[model samples]
Target: MKTRNQKGLESKYWLLIIVAACILCMAATFFAGVKSGPVRVIADYTVVPMQKGINVIGTWVNGVADNFVTLKSVQKENKTLKEQNANLKMENNQLQQKAVELERFYDLYKMDQNTSDYPKVGARVIANDGSNWFTSFTIDKGSADGIREDMNVLSGNGLVGIVTKVNAHSSTVRSIIDEVNISSMIMTTFDQCIVSGDLKLINNGVVKFEQLANNENEVAVGEQIVTSNISSKYLQGLLIGYVSEVNVDSNNLTRSGYIIPAVDFKKLQEVLVITTTKQDLIDNGNQTQSDSSEK
Candidate 1:
């Protein structure tokens, strides 16, 4: 530290000597006038450029300081906007979840209204076979809830399937799209047909329909088909599906087609079970099961 102080003092002493020398040179120039030609020329060339270089360096330093201040302000604003964006994303996710739940409740209400006449048991789908079809799935309700074999199951819009197996707490439903199932349906014009499940077509949201009476009755596309009055397991007037394709066979005795089912099997989550069984129909009740055979 002491050495540093001594060096600084020596630097000040040299600066004073340089100033004294400059003053003497100016005095000589004033006395000799233009006659001090070479000295004056040299000073003008060296000093003016040096002073201009110093001014340029000072301007660059000032510019750098101003830019640093502006950069800080921009960084602060960017941080604030990033926080707000994160908050907005979180809020949007919550709203989307609420929307899905609300839609589920609305569907439940519609199913209740459609099956108001029957004393029904509501069940939530708990397990699936993970196949491309809703051929077999387990529900939250079972024998304890009065769910029995061959009981007709319905979804929001129409019939779904029949209960095949029941446990103490849950029941398994074999959806109408199952390959082993068949249904008897009647068109709006009272024309009869046999609807059967086809594994190949279930993935496409349609079932197979055949044995349609080939009469003057026209089975057009989009015509609604419901459980026939003569059905033994399914209730009459319960919508099964809509006619999608219709064509007369080579024999000309019957027409065959595809039907788009009323239940969106892929989206099944909750279902309703009609408390009344097929025996109820045989015992003079309204609903009955289908006993149709494949064509």
Candidate 2:
């Protein structure tokens, strides 16, 4: 039953005694040295083991800290390398696309040099309405670029379609593979025929041609077909396709056949618009209605 002040004094006195004992032990160790005697034996059994344990703990902690620093550096380097790889892949893709575009331009150049020599505006296919066929699609050029409705659109190889709709900045081309699209084509011998689109035939990459003159016209499987002089809408002599199959109808009056189109409808990426329309030629007195009359 001691008072609060009495208990506090007892605690202080015990703390001083412990401190004095600790100082005496430290001074004894300093004077006695650790190389020999009972003092050394006491150090080995007590302070030496404690110091060894502390050194072991410090070594482990330092190793852990160093490992964390190395891990952080490795993660940062990996992130930087991944970003560089992605950027390089993007650059390679861009270069490949540019090369493809350049090749297409060269093809168009050759076509322009060999054919009608008419003025043309080159346009890229911006969008396609059909998935498996080029029945209809939009171009990047339009009226503002001198493109007009019914203007004959040609690819690198031959006829692609005609511009059907035009806006200020873009135009829609109705491809020859469209159901309603038709072309008057003539064989090498001036034998006239009608080339029309059929969804069934186009699925096979060919189109229907009929009314081939039955005079034993001798149309072969590989004969070339071109836009006829009788086509009022299309420019004459534009390559249509090559005759693929030929057979006289049951009536034995006219031959019906199919032609593989000169232009690959499924791969239409760019086209050339012949700015000189058939109507334009007729207006300029370069063509006659008699020549463009439907056969």
Candidate 3:
């Protein structure tokens, strides 16, 4: 009983000492806090870094979202531009085709106006015989279009050729440059001569005029050559060519020269046909009637 009492008293004393120490430590902590003036809680360092981080995250997310929206808008604009370009190309092609058709119609209208009196027919040149001796071209119009042999063919400028043969759908034109054709002429001077076709020297688009009246004096260059009034086939005063060169014999009895043809045979495209039988008479009558009316 006495030992038990002593142990209990010792245990009570240690418990009291531990309680007192804990109380003293708590008091010291309180005193230190007071001395430090409530610890002056400074949020400047920690709170500022957290706020900056939030701002950076928000800015990054906003930038990404804006970029995505801008990209989508650009793609849509590109697609629209592509479609507009395609539409413009289609419109341009249509306009080009219309312009071509209008040009063809204008050509046809002009041709019609030119051949009002004559029973004329417009024909397109289909093929050319690649020979200087023959010098013929095929036209699209033939017997079906009232085309016949010996019909005079004229281009927009002047006479082109004569129809020699006709097929069902096409006709052949014998150009004036052929060797078989002859163009008679009276000199612009006081001399009379005949211009004959020679295919040998026709490479330079000229012909030889033989049996000139005044062969003693050489013919001057640049003199105009026209179809003679006595020509059985061709009309008078039709411009044949220009005098380029003159060759005279030693005895001065006969002379020949080069004549550059008026028409460029290589570029022949559209032509007119003189189908009227009394075309010359009709032309003269009209001129006379006009003169009478004017008077």
Number of backbone-clashing residue pairs for each candidate, in the order shown: 5, 0, 0
Candidate 3, residues 1-295: lDDT per residue as tens digits? 9999999999999999999987865555445444333331222333345557889999999999999999999999999999999999999999998996566556556645755655677888888997544479999998888888877776654456678899989999998877655555645653556776666677766777766654455467878776665555665555667788877756667676777776666667677776643346557779999999999
Q: What is the lDDT of residue 241 in candidate 3?
A: 70
lDDT for residue 17 in candidate 2, whole number 0-100:
100
- Cα TM-score of candidate 1: 0.70
Per-residue C-alpha lDDT of model 1 across residues 1-295, encoded as one tens digit per residue:
9999999999999999999989966665454444456766765566546557888999999999999999999999999999999999999999998897678767767877866777787889998899856779999998888888989888877888888899999999988888754556665688877888887897777888898878998777899988876676777677888888898988999999898999888888878889887677676432222323321
* CA displacement after TM-score superposition, residue 18 of candidate 1 (Å): 11
lDDT value, candidate 3, whole model: 0.70
The positional error of residue 120 in candidate 2, measured at the CA in angstroms, is: 0.6
Candidate 2 wrongly placed segments (more than 4 Å) = 1-33, 126-133, 140-144, 165-170, 180-192, 212-224, 242-248, 251-255, 264-269, 282-295
Q: Give all candidates' CA lDDT scores.
A: 0.81, 0.85, 0.70
Candidate 2: deviation at residue 97, Å? 3.4
Query: Worst lDDT window (10 residues) for model 2?
Result: 286-295
CA shift of 286, model 3, Å: 22
lDDT (Cα, tens digit) per residue for candidate 2, span 1-295: 4698899999999999999989976766574466988888877777677667889999999999999999999999999999999999999999999999889888898889867568998899999995888889999998889988889999998988888899999999988878754556556688888898887888887898898878855788889888887688898888889999998888888888999999888888889999988888878764466556744
Error at 157, model 1, angstroms: 2.7
